[model samples]
Structures are given as structure tokens and as C-alpha cells.
Target: MLVRLALAALSLHAVTAAPAPQGATTWYAVSTTPQGDTVSPPTHWYAVDTSSTTTPSSRTTSSSTVASSTSSSASSSSSSAPASSTAIVSSKKGVGYNDEYLTRELAISWAYNWKSRRGGELSEGVTYEPMLWGRNATGWATDAQLGLDEGASALLHLNEPDIWSQSAMNVTEGIDSWLTNMSPFYGKTNLVSAAVSNSPEAANLRWLQYFFGNCTQCEQETHAVALHWYSDSFNTSAFKTWFTDAYELLQKPIWITEFGVQRFTSSSNVTQKQEFLEDVIPWMEAQPFIERYAAFGTFPGRFVNDDGSLTALGRTYSETV
Candidate 1:
């Protein structure tokens, strides 16, 4: 497809370096363009000799525009840490994409937080969050252990349970699972609710009713809400209406883990994505209840290109940051 070719071109911006030996530690300083997209020939570079046996961990540090980071744990964690702090892992400006393909150094090299599926290494100054998929108790246990070991600040619960293709849990089952597996981590780390699918069927009011009615333990144990938003209509009102309704019901801080104007069905919608970001970014940044948010991805027609170069959408999204 033409889109794939464009993304292939986008990845060409990455710096060429000798691959690290298997299990060897390597460091890279991911530089950003004036537009805030990742590019080659890092502005500054440093590498420390690391042991092959070092158990990876996730921490984030920042200096002006640069985020100093170390990596461990794959995508989907939460945090209340300040975004500008160079010594903490925060969820403030995050991303959800393929860590193996795009990489922290390639796609979201400048970002503060990011996630994929399983745990992996990241560039300096970026925090990685681990996600629990479906009702898989095994996966949850694994991520929970990783969180405890790495001292993660927060934990993202199930993926979109409202969608069949994702977690697909009924209300009773969702609450029960949360109490059994996720509640124990309540005081240990912030527990972000399972992200609901982006539709009225996953209505905030309805879902909350089911959850609050059944799970009394999770009511007080949980810390924040995670959300996913995508709109066919690219406008301020569309974005505002959905979030406003959800905010009214939840009355808790919100973290928009995945968001975009529309799915990447065509390249012609670049302007639409840009317009949407221009309106939404400032609004979300100003809202007191919004804890953190990450755009849908870094692919073509999304925020940035596969190689982390800024697209028009990326430019608009990074304007305030």
C-alpha cells in the first residue's frame, strides 16, 4: 500500500549505528526536530557500559526538551509524577504503539511515557507502562510482578473490555476480576480502570453504574480512569461532548491513553487530524481533571511517522509541549 511506503520513508530519519551485541546495553540520545519529531544524528549522545545481566527498570528524567530515561516493562502504566521533572517516571505525555517496530528511540523518542505489549528496553528519560490483556490472570500476575520489581508508579488495568476484540468482559466479571487481582495493588500503585471502548455502548454512566453497584472494594481502591477516544467528526464539539459526558459521571482524573480524530483509512484526512489536535490539545492541557494523555500512534496520518518524524498532526499535537 501507498501508506506503508510513506511510513517506510518516514523511518529513514533514524540514525545508523552499529547494533549492540546480544544482551549488551547500548545508549542513544533521541533528538527531536524543531517540530518535535524524532530525527537522526542525535543532538547529544552518551553511553555507559552496562552488564548483560542488569535487570532492566523504568525511570524518566528530563532537562528542558530532553527526557533522560532507562527502560523496562512494556506499555501501559500510570503515574501522577510531574512532566517536567527529570528524575521521575510520569504519564503526562505518553504514546501507545509497537515498541518493537517503532521503538522508543524511533517513534516516541522525545515522549515521557510509552507502552507496547510486553516489557522491553527504552531510551533514556522515557517511562514504560505494562498493560493487562483481557481476563488473563496469568498476564496480570506477570505485569504485577514487574510493577512491584520496577517500583512502577501506576498500573493500567484491562484493555477495552467493552469491545469484543479486546478484553470483552461483562460487568460482573470485570468487577470481580478487578477485586481479586487488581485491588491488592491499590495502595502499592495507582490502579487505572480498564479503558472502555470509544462508543456510546460503552457509555460512561452505564458502565460506572455496573461497576460501582457490584464492586464496592474497587470503588475506593481504584485511583484513576483510563479512556480511549476516536471520533468520525473532527471538531471541538465532538471531542468536548464525549469527554464532558464522561467527566460528569466519573468525577475523577482522566488519562486518555489512546486518542485520534479518526482511524487511518485515508491520507487525505491529515488536515482533519491537525484541526482536531489544534482544538483538543489546548483544551485537554488546560483541564485540571486531565492527568495525562497520549495520541493514538506515530504512523502516517496519525501524530507522527513510523520513524518518529512529525507529520502535520504531530506538529499540532506538540505545539504546547
Candidate 2:
């Protein structure tokens, strides 16, 4: 239903965008290219993490607001409560992994890869949230349908659309693609949105605000919002600022589908990554609004050893509460 939009009706006072600062704009996050990229990876995406300012742009409000989005037809689906199930016991922690079987080791709570199918024979009760990567990801619609038919509880929308490399899509294209491919599944499952990048320029929030403004039906259907975060080193203050800005604008429960240190580089030490994890995981769990989160697993850093064992960082993330 339009729960996302409904939850978003709560408005902030007369506010405006804050001036961009230096420290926040210095970092960039290059999305890790999927192995199946038939050709060379595109150029890196350097997001300017502007100061955490929930500046009210031209109707770029919360993920859930805007009165004139969709038509009456949308209410047909919106009328129905999303399919519910006891299969997924709620937990704030999950593993982001490419290989599902390896998750059996860290089997903390949940796991998801880039695709729709729950990888093979996943641990029982380990909820597998399927992601429809993007419009560029061929057969995304069909795959999303398959996941819904298979009783996937929560279906993720576009990846990092704010980033040119990952799930690159403008607000209009994102809405059109979603309405055509993902809208039909609206009330059938928990639909996550935009999966906006941690663009330092505050592009992620803007992208979402525009999306919610333009596509009322799409915005109405989105059950939760998704955010991706990355930083060169473990800077918890930067982390908090980014997440806070998003929540203040969106006002919806969040699913941090991807996050990590050394987002696009290998310079991150295991200890630093562990410090990052130890610092963020508890903070994430403590936040009542952060429904669930999954780190960028397997690549860019070592979540599992080549022998299929948890690395120190992995163990820290897996074993921590």
C-alpha cells in the first residue's frame, strides 16, 4: 500500500538545504562491478557527501509524500495489505553475500545476493530478500515475478541509481521502469525503493524525493526505503550524519542493502574493516528505524576466506549482536 507515503506525511518545519562543507565532499565510492559485466567497468563514481542537511528542494520531500503521484487504479493494490508470513522472523542483522551456502557458516539471520533466486538450499528461517538490480539488469521484471511467486517477503528495487556505475537511472527512468517492471508486485510483497547511493552531493535523497513526488503509485507502493553507504576509512561521525539525513527526509524504515569501508579500494586493513564493522553493526542494531542491513560481502573485502571460512572482520560482524 501507500504506507511509505503515508508514513511520510509527517513534515519537517520550514527548512532549507545547508551549504556543502569540505570534509563531506572529499570522498567517493566506486560501485563494485558485478563479474558478469561483459566489458570493462565504467569510470568510478565519486559522491560528494554534502553536510547532512535535509534541505527542502522543489517537492523533493520525504520518500513517502506528495499528494499528486498516482491514479485511482493504484488504490486497488494499495487497498490490500502486503502478503504477510511467519517464515521471516524479524532480525536487524543479515549477511550480504554472493555465495549463499557460505552464509550457512555465519548464518546470523538473513542473506541476499544481487539476483532474485534465493541461492540454493539456504538455511531455514534465514530470510532471503531478493533484489531487482536495475533496468540494465535484463529480465529483472521476470525475475522479480518469480521471487514473488516463490514467496519472497521483501523485494528490493533499483540498486545505487544515484551512482553512474551501479544501477544508473534518473528519477523519471527509475519511475517508469519500476511501474512497468516492479509495480505489479506492489502489494504482493514488501517493496523497497530507489536504493539511492550515498552520493555526497545529497543526490540519493534528492533522487528519492523526486521519485516520490512524480510517481505517486510507485511511491505509494514502496514499503521501505533502501540506502547504501561507503567511506574510505571508518569514520563513524560521517556514517551517522549520512544515515540521519536520509531518515530525516524519508521518515520510513530503512534497509541498508550495501555498506563497507574502502568502498572501491583495497587499502582497508582487516582491522580497520573490523573496527568499521564493530562500530556500525551495534549502532545499526540500536537504531529502531533501521529495519535491516546487509554489508557488501565477498568482494572488495574478504568476508569469507578462499577456504569458505569467516575472516576476522566477517567473524566480528557475524558473531556480534
- The candidate scoring highest on TM-score is 2
Task: List lDDT for all candidates, in order.
Answer: 0.52, 0.60
lDDT for residue 248 in candidate 1, whole number 0-100: 53
Q: Which candidate leads in lDDT?
A: 2
For model 1, how does the per-residue alpha-carbon lDDT over 1-321 read when each residue is reduced to its tens digit?
001213322321133364433444334222112211211222323222233222222222222211111112213223323342222233356666544334432322223122223445555545556666556576566666675566456677766555433454556667878887887777777777877645543333345445655566776776667877765667678776676556555655677887765444256777766667767866765555566677756454455565655566555554433
Tens digits of per-residue lDDT, candidate 2, 1-321, equal 001111112221112243323364433343333334422334544333234323335423442332222111121101111122222222666656665325455534566777666666555556677786666657766777776676567888776666545565666678788887778777788888868767454367777876776677877788779888765557888997677567766766678887766432243476777777778877776565677887766432356666666666766766555
For each candidate in turn, give its C-alpha RMSD to the true structure in angstroms: 18.1, 11.6
**Pairs of residues clashing in candidate 2:** 5-64, 17-55, 48-200, 48-201, 49-200, 50-200, 69-216
lDDT of the structure predicted as candidate 1:
0.52
Question: How well does candidate 2 match the true structure in TM-score terms?
Answer: 0.70
